[model samples]
Target: MSFEVDIGYASARGPREDNEDFAAVVRPAPHDEARGLIAAVADGVSSGGQGRLAAQTTVMSLVQDFHGVPETWDTTVALDRLISAQNAWLAGHNRRRSGEGTAMCTLTALVLRGHSYTLAHVGDTRAWLLRGGECIQLSQDHSFDHPDLRHALSRAIGLDDHVRVDYSQGELHRGDVFVLTTDGVHGVLRRRELAARAREGSAQAASEALVEAALKAGSRDNATALVIRVAGLAAGRLEDLLLRGRQLPVPPKLRVGDLLDGYVITAMLADNGVHRLYQARSVATQALVAIKALHEARASDPQERAMLAHEAWLGSRVARDGQAGLVRVHELEDPSAFYVVYDWHSGQTLEQLIEDGRRLDVSEVVDAGRAVLKPLGRLHRQGVIHRDIKPANLHRGDDGQWRLLDLGVAVSGREPEAARSLHAGTPSYINPEQWQPDDPVRADAGSDLYALGVTLYQALTGRLPYGEIEPYQLARFRRDPRAPSQVRPDVPIWLDHVLLKAVARDPKLRFETAEEFALALERGASRPLPAHGSTPLVARDPAVLWKIALVVSLLFNALLIVWLLFLPR
Candidate 1:
């Protein structure tokens, strides 16, 4: 169950193409003898935002970080780190160019170890396995249902507010060939054609052949392909794999007994960027608690330092406000060069709950809303706007309650200091007014209501209210989205109305405050639930329809056969 690999990449700008559609290769780091590999293909989103930059950054970062990937790394963590880093970089880059921001791009990255491989992807760029004279697709295309699909990518790096990557792991066998390519290749060359190319020659040759085929087939975009041939098995070198390359700046090592401020460091949560969340004891009462240390490097950076400070202050504000639905920030203390102290409840993030495949029943969504809206209402009353309100920030406690986290981007009206700072938040959940250049009233209550609407949409339909769109495309569809009931029929009508109003694109149309929104939702939930209607006319008796359709098909075929076999003869 182990093997070395042969890697090669081939790319071509097709007839109707201008920008290169394909970028793929394996970076060989001399320092890391771990034999790590990074194979990626990015299809630049053609509309705007330096798509090439998005592709190049994604590929370059993955290659640089591939050598140090953890053996026991969770795909979720890897994806989060990759996309989050890219986003911060993109955000900074975008600030320089008012309208020339980097364009989003589809991404597929693979890390290989002996015979095992890990894959992560967004959009339509894909990975495939060619074995036993057959080519099997290993990735699904994130595209809308359409005849041609075109350049519409469901997910792309640096495009949307957040990148949600689909990740998977698999075993590699000797003689098995893996192909990674942008849409130009698979969208043009058929699977049979790819399989034929895989059987023709070495990995390098096969890669070239596939790209050529895509060009011959009139692929109208940049075509890129990678061929990886499994050579043979070798020893598992997990540690060597991650530590061999260019030195990664390591944070100071922490120990269990080390005390900073009033909190005690327990253990390291992760390797990079100092994810040392500690179990600290209260100095006043000797009660155990949890705290997180920000990376010293990040703390030293001016922008990051400001964010850390803001996070600490916001945490304390929420706690002092006595909001039941937010993590209580007891006090701001420099546990280390960078850290925040908060009263921690043992609970899972909303993301963790979703990952656990736990569906939020209607009552659960309501109860969770009650928890979230109350704290939000409190913050609003204090003239605080939590710009980054989303599921990842929602923590579900053991007491069957939910809470908010990381209000670093929060805006407090009373603070002349905060009022001067510019807009900040995850774009997917942000209100339009928050993103505006000019300062509007920014009803803290109104913004919170909008986020609650989005949360409800996600809770019921398992999808975003406005669907996925690139950053540049945001302006095109700024209006309120179709109601939730249209997207998910089973959603209660009253709840749907409540959510729609909360997320209404027009502030004038949305609820006046979080409390008001909560009241409306509560009323919606209080009404008697309706039963699902009877089966539609088309579905009432499928058997009758099937029989009628079958008879028609049979008669048509019989007539065609008679024409060919008897009448024509």
Candidate 2:
């Protein structure tokens, strides 16, 4: 099955001299099926002189420019960029015609991609969804209630230098009806009436009926309604995600001066058994980039191929400033092989810095922790967890900026249940709960926090908090490990306390959020530190206590045997 939609739109001048409302639906071409369908409606501010122009320009730009966005970009990201650009253009146009008047409008757009629909809105133009005979508003009005003016827009395009658009996304299902309308239509019609009319007939009939009903109800402004019914939904497939990567052949081994597509390899950056990283320069752009390719042997494995593709896909979803951005895949010319390309930065791995015995100042350490945690926070907010967070996976740029890298094992909120149990992170860095045999290991914000604490501790002193935990070893956490202060006397007392609390044996004891942890490091510990040696020996070192018990048992047995012999038993 494939995505199919029935779309209809209607606009009327009502009592107004001219219609200031615009609406349209643009269906993707056969080759652009992945881009899916776009429907939008815009309402121009009646008081504005160029209301008609603003409304028409806003809707037209959204439907046309949306297609120009890179196919690899997430729908929300693409829509946001397009909307922002349109806003800038409209604002500039208004400034140029400042003597005449300014143009302003409210826009609401819905993009149906894959099995989901993303809603982008600004101003008072509204978006609604009708399912199971119920109508629900999907977009919030940017207007406010004023005593003098019944309804005044608080936000709108072309009204300011910056526009803040609201966005939301939800799964799509067959038979779902989406409605877009200007305030004139929705303000006059009741929710119950709107739902009933929208569900009664074909999309075109429904749209017309809704607008007529609004006019009959005495609407004084221009009325517009756009209706979209999901006729069918495509069954999700892996190929949809893998896309080009699935069709391309795995890249072969490369040496210096070897070329693939437009990139020429300069040197081998890393060569782990599973994959290889090469430092290369694009012949076309003359820009440096890092290309990662799976080893030929592992390329045949479907799981490995998916992981590599997913890493690139996930990298593209994150904002560049938040994580190491992926080079635009669409820019690469037709290639003989598949590989992921990343923008190269001159930097040293945190692991290498630690291994080199570079002394880090307290301020430097705190700054690094804050920098790394910021991206991790962004990932968490996006419902992504970086299962594998370690010093080796973090880079300290020559510009003194730290960025988190390697999304190969990152788990998203939409990940399947079976995939959640798969062990994907470093054994030493994984939290205790993740290693429990009976407990299901799922990546969450707390898990990332645990790893962040471990990372901070290792950076401060080149040592693991729980030592090197082997993959086969069953991890057990009975007590806290040695504090950072114990290893480095120069470590501040409060900072040590903060780190200890972060990597606490219990997830509940750890800082609840990355922001909290960053704040603790930025400003000294908010709470008092526990006294040293507060924990008992049995809890702190169970292995040592067990050894002592074994020795005592042997001595007692030896004495018992001597007594038995002397008593003539």
lDDT, each prediction: 0.67, 0.80
Indicate which candidate wins on TM-score: 2
Model 2: residues with Cα > 4 Å off, grouped in runs:
1-35, 38-241, 321-336, 414-419, 472-479, 525-565
lDDT digits (tens) for residues 1-569 of candidate 2: 56788888888999998898888889988766777889889998745459889889888998998898886678889898888988899889888888887889999999887656789999888899998767899998887777766578899988887899999877667788999999999999999998887876789999999999999999999999999999886533223345445666788899999998988999998888889999999998999989989988887776777777666666756744424322233223235687888888788888888888888887788888888888888888888888988888888888777878888788774443434567888888888777666665666889989998898898887888888887645444555588788888998899888888877766667888888887777777555455334346565444777889899999999999999888776
**What TM-score would each prediction reach against the true structure?**
0.44, 0.56
Summarize candidate 1's per-residue lDDT along 139-237 as a digit string, tens digits: 998887787865566777765556678887665456778888888888888888878876667778888989888888988878888888877644333
Model 1 worst lDDT run, 10 consecutive residues: 238-247
